[model samples]
Target: MDETTYKFLMGASAFVIAILGLMLAGTTILPEVGLEKLRKARSILIPSYFVLALLSLVCCLTGYDRRIEPASTLLVASFQALLFTMSMLVFIRPNEVRWKTVFRQAGVITVAGLVLFVSFFRFTDYYSCFFYSGVVAYVLQLIIYTRKFMLAYRKTVQEVEDYYDDDEENRLVWVKCGFFSALAVGIMALSILFFPVLYKYFVPLYVVFYSFMVMWFVNYYRRMKFAIPVIAAMPQEADVCAIPETVLAKTDGVAAEEAVAVAEEAVAVKEEKSGAEHLLKERLQKYIDEKEYCRKDVPSGIVADSFGMSKAFFRQYMKDSYGMDFRPWRKELRLREASRLFAGHPEYTIEEVSEMVGYNNSSNFNRDFKRMMGMTPKCFCKQFQ
Candidate 1:
């Protein structure tokens, strides 16, 4: 492509990137993530990214193009900021290890600062050194991101070794795919730097590559929009799931007291019974005791099917015997098992427990956990520790 075409392409790509940034900025209220540090991290990163995209677009549109020093600085700096911002995001995901994440963020930032400082000194001899340095820095960032992703992948496999959510596992697989795709584009852009003689010819290529990165970023943003709430809610759900009897015994309000009384009566009937209700309870209890309901997708039909019964029959039987339907009954089973797991393994995180109990999304787990448990997972764990 000619210089005119390349300039237009860069400008157009920048505009698209700015729009993506705006879309990302549109969802600022993350009721999922409870940590102030994470909240601050996202609040800063999104606005900063949006600002950088806008600035780059402005630079591209102005007479001061990529060949010029000022525009080049703005564009390259924007790319570097994008890389570093994403790295920090990985550090802020709902993980059990905060110190490690903090250390990684500090290390990446320190290294980035040093690289930028050194590249600036070399900038006088070679203007493209600024972008060349950006490519390398992004490579380093992808390395950090990939490492963190690998750790998360391992956690998904090792912690919940037996149970796996196909959809959840599929999403985890995409984590690597997204990072690798960006890294591959980064490498393609970086390799062009070696052939500085034809770098202008490749400038359009850079625009395409940069656009690819932004597109991947949009995908990440979309994923997080849903994932954050689940991640935020995991702990509360697990802890509340841990102590069912204790949770059920408390009556903070009239409605809660009635609910607790109903649960108690149900329990009392189970203890003092030998009829259809007791028989049904025995069959379901035995199945639940065997850790069968740990998968979050355990529908009543599926469970009943396993026991050679129809979904309708099971649902009616559960309602008649315990004044409840399948959903609450299954939740009670999960909570009891999760509580058992928490009491036995105090070190187990909400993430781990949520996974074990079949919650693929931590945000949903956390929300449900709080709604039912009345306390966060971390708070519940602390009571024991």
Candidate 2:
């Protein structure tokens, strides 16, 4: 094919990709529209995409006439305009701040983009001013959007934390996704500032960035795992689900008081039965107290077996009473014992102290010590001297 034909094909393909993106975004939002309004918006956007595609193809074929090209430019420009308008509309509607704020920020960008287009219209004569203004506007929009997104994300994170403490793993995953989404949006906006001079190259870069964002939302919705249970009688009211009795009991003062009383009574009755149990607990505590457990890389399962209890039951009991799993509890015990040893036996090097604490690696010991004490073990020991 000739050079002109190749350029035409390339421009047409880019326009098609843009249209596909627009179609995806459009369909995703259609469920929110009133039935009567839906048909009208779809009609306008669908035809606009085809018309602009054809116009872009024609401009490429006819040697890139500015007037002819501007039609295609306007088509591209209209995407931002629609985005801005939608953002403003959502902002004005009640209970739509998330959508509204997003769109409003987008709208500001779209309006500023008109200035960038005007710069391109006079690119040869005022190239520097055009580039600077475009870059400035893009940067400003990125900052505004990033701030708004982070604020909304923090609000959502707190809500998630308050509502679902049990599913902490999923909540953390969503928080990470939300952070990356904001970062992606910022990167895409920054990429656009370069598009005026290097339009052909960065076009695909923008497309891929946006595609990843859409995929992120899809993944987030999928990973929320637990279902919101349905309630028939209170159709309008929010659904409720059963919380673990143990979790609820901790917070209910009367239940907690009753539990404590029952625990004391049980302990008194079980004193004779608990001679073996007390001996086992004491052995574990002594190992920790003497720093022997820290010196050896002893598994909690092995400890439980030595004490004549199943590892599972031992883990459950420790978790219920102490609110820590075996590994962390043991680590804390070892670290505490290690801290004392390190302070008293100043002749031992940091590496020797680490080995004594059951940490195979000095770096790991240092990290754990700093995490628990807010300082390195050596620094912590120096305070005494």
Candidate 3:
């Protein structure tokens, strides 16, 4: 087969692989046990993957020529533009399902796409510039979008861990899967940009990476062993035996011995209860001290596993003991840490401080800080200064 055909085939393979991976990752029937949060995430990612796949096809069909037919150029450029815009909107306004941002982004993408599409035929000399510039712009936007998504993922994980009682295991599955998916996409982008010649060769690598993602989802769903609720189980109080006055009066010596045995058993039960409580407290403190809970995206399953408790039980414990849900608790912890970091670490920038306290966006950091501390990071810093 000719080089163009080979490239097209490779692109098609990548597209197929990406689609299959997304289906596996998102579909409930794929034997991948994911929580509701993960399911929602998959819903977003599946379409994103398809857009990326279409872009790859466009690139492959257009070939490496600077002077391509106007029709072909339009197809390639239009797809790239659409892909870039959709990615940005998806990254930014993920929660808004009305397609408002999607439509807006699509408009921008179409304008840019049309310019390149028409320019290919109208001005062959500038084809390289148009193509390369559009690619670079798309890549840049993708990088920003990916970073934002990663941050959002972390926050979601943290919220899941703090608020939900059951499905701790499932939460971790989703977080880890999402993290690796983003990482894989980033790596693919870097390879395509920096090593264009090797792009065709990397088809197998993409296949492998996505295959693992699918497998992970399938395995996680099948196990589904981590569905313990947080508040469902309370420690039972030990029964205290009451002795009748007649028995005690008639038995004399035997009665005294029986009473002593009962006292010993009661003492043992109390000690056991105290020890259990102490162990739980120590575990909880360790979780806090490690700073894992501070991550915006940490899932409750991870924390529950760390404490050797079921997710439901952990949720109940946090509610009963802390009197707040997981998200609020994490927010409170992050803000407190951000405050301390701001006061003590004068050398760090506000951005750095925000990241250290588990914030992905500086704007979010500032907003959360002001809401919690009643001032911006700069103002808070002035107090320490």
Candidate 4:
């Protein structure tokens, strides 16, 4: 490419990068979601945009110098690495990530990338080989992470499913789309290795795509109240089914009378808790028999409140007793009601059955029915006829 054309391309990229950086800066500071982990992850984009802007500046300064090309490749690789790291922070459980460890790893990566950039350009005669090797490494890492991300994505979807009955809205399936889109765009960006001339055109498009993704992610998660309760070390209430080991241990040195009293008190507490659990179980079964779960969009908090329990405790009780989360357990009740309706009222249409069973979306109802019953609703109904 001519010097005039190269300068114009670099100038345009610099202007675009500056605009993109400003937009990212505004969002990072005033993100729509108040989640601390998400906010921290978005903050990483601030430096990413700056890295991009700096890369554009460097390209302009070096103006097609083949030796400096390796440096530019390394910069792009580093940016991609940061992006993948940010996504890992976004998808994983907030408490699972250690930001200090992440920062330390990032520091190591930056230093290694710098060393490679300088060593290959200044000392080695194998600049071309180094550039190709870097590209190969980046692609290999991307492929490996993409597979890992698939597993994480499925687990996240299952977590969401465990909370919300309406799988159509709550399953974080859109995140998978966003992930693969970014992967495609990253691959396109790396194509600069083979087609350097197209970089001038591609960079602007890449910037715009990334900007759209940022807005979509922020807006969607802002309205979503996604939560997965962490398990506690001990039950919150003093009334528990089992006595703490500490209680029994502390009785070793006590007088025989005191020890007997402690043992008797513990037994009383245990019996009280056991009776309460049995009563709760009976009340819940009666609630199910009445088909209270057939109500549309009943909040779990309200359901728990009716039973004089907190939502977290109610959910834990359901999991422990039924071997399933609240939503899944509710789903089973709904589907069972639907099956009964199909058998007893064969005149009912699929949509009617779905609505009666608390499913607003017939498509989702059919999907879930077929998955559980191993046949579609229409086919299931025909069995009775």
The C-alpha stretches of model 3 lying farther than 4 A from their native spots are 1-26, 29-98, 164-194, 209-385
lDDT tens digits by residue: candidate 3, 28-87: 643232243345545554665665566556667665542343234334334433343333
**What's the distance in Å from true for residue 369, model 1?**
33
Error of 4 at 362 (Å): 6.3
Candidate 3 matches the true fold with a TM-score of: 0.41
The count of backbone overlaps in candidate 2 is 2
**Clash totals, every prediction:** 12, 2, 22, 0
What shift in Å separates residue 206 of candidate 4 from its native position after superposition? Answer: 2.6
**What's the lDDT for candidate 1?**
0.56
Cα RMSD to the true fold for all candidates: 16.6, 13.8, 16.7, 5.9
Q: Can you write out model 4's per-residue Cα lDDT over 158-273, one digit (the tens) per residue?
A: 64443344574433555676677677667776776567777666666666666765665456444344432311112235433232322755635779988888788888877865
Comparing 3 with 4 on lDDT, the higher-scoring candidate is 4
**lDDT of each candidate versus the true structure:** 0.56, 0.51, 0.56, 0.67
lDDT of 3: 0.56
Residue 355 lDDT in model 2?
74
lDDT of 1 at 41: 48
Which 10 successive residues of model 4 have the least lDDT summed? 227-236
Worst 10 residues of 3 by lDDT: 239-248
How far residue 281's Cα lies from its native spot in candidate 3, in Å, is: 17
For residue 9, give model 3's deviation from the true position in Å: 4.7
